[model samples]
Target: MVERVVATEEAIQLINKLKSIHGPLMFHQSGGCCDGSSPMCYQEGELKVGASDVLLGHIGGSPFYIAADQYAYWKHTQLIIDVVNGRGGMFSLEGPEGKRFLTRSRVFTEEERKELQL
Candidate 1:
């Protein structure tokens, strides 16, 4: 099962907003540039949680779901999804702060930021 690190209030708010539009909030941690992980928001039908899937605690009372395939990578990972207020709905991730992994993906995009209302 995947564990949940302490999430910030901004992170919880973003999750709540995503959950309102979608059914639940789903993200995954996989091999990336650095020895760290990157969180990617998935659409409702994009996630495939199974019996072996881990049910991590909620963020701001919103259920955070992680797929079974991503459990191993997230075991010791610290994921913090925070919103950059007054920044055009931009969000930030703070954990290991590994520059390699953060740069691997365009984690934050103008369109995505606006969509999530970050």
Candidate 2:
């Protein structure tokens, strides 16, 4: 099955580290005006999710979500979560770790899209 979201090795390492220190984690794709499309990391359930948030999939065993409205703009692409040097959103757990989660994407191919029923 096609995964709508996945993490890179660097990201997985960081996620594991964060999990060790913070326990389970989750990711929410930030909509614009601040962090842009930055992936904000938080302890699992730190931020409540509901019908308005779409579960894109998981990365490094962490559930990833995007606002239902934002999903409409990203439904056709795969979200690649990566790690880089920088501070993330103030509210994200990773902000204090000197590293931030980044969201990169590529439009799904016809076959990939079909596999995902997109």
List TM-scores for all candidates, in order.
0.42, 0.95
Model 2 per-residue lDDT at 38:
88
Question: Which 10 consecutive residues of model 2 have the lowest summed lDDT?
Answer: 29-38
Candidate 1: where are CA atoms >4 Å away?
Answer: 1-3, 33-37, 49-56, 61-78, 84-118
For 1-118, candidate 2 gives per-residue lDDT tens digits of 8889989999999999999999999999858767756888889999888878898999999999998888999999999999899888888888888998888899999999889887
* Tens-digit lDDT track of model 1 for 1-118: 3324445555666666666766655554433433323454555447565676565555555445555566455544444544443322012222212211121212434554455444
Cα-based lDDT for every prediction: 0.45, 0.89
The superposed Cα distance between candidate 1 and the true structure at residue 83, in angstroms, equals 3.3
Error of 2 at 5 (Å): 0.2
The Cα RMSD of model 1 versus the native structure comes to 13.6
| Alpha-carbon lDDT of model 2 | 0.89
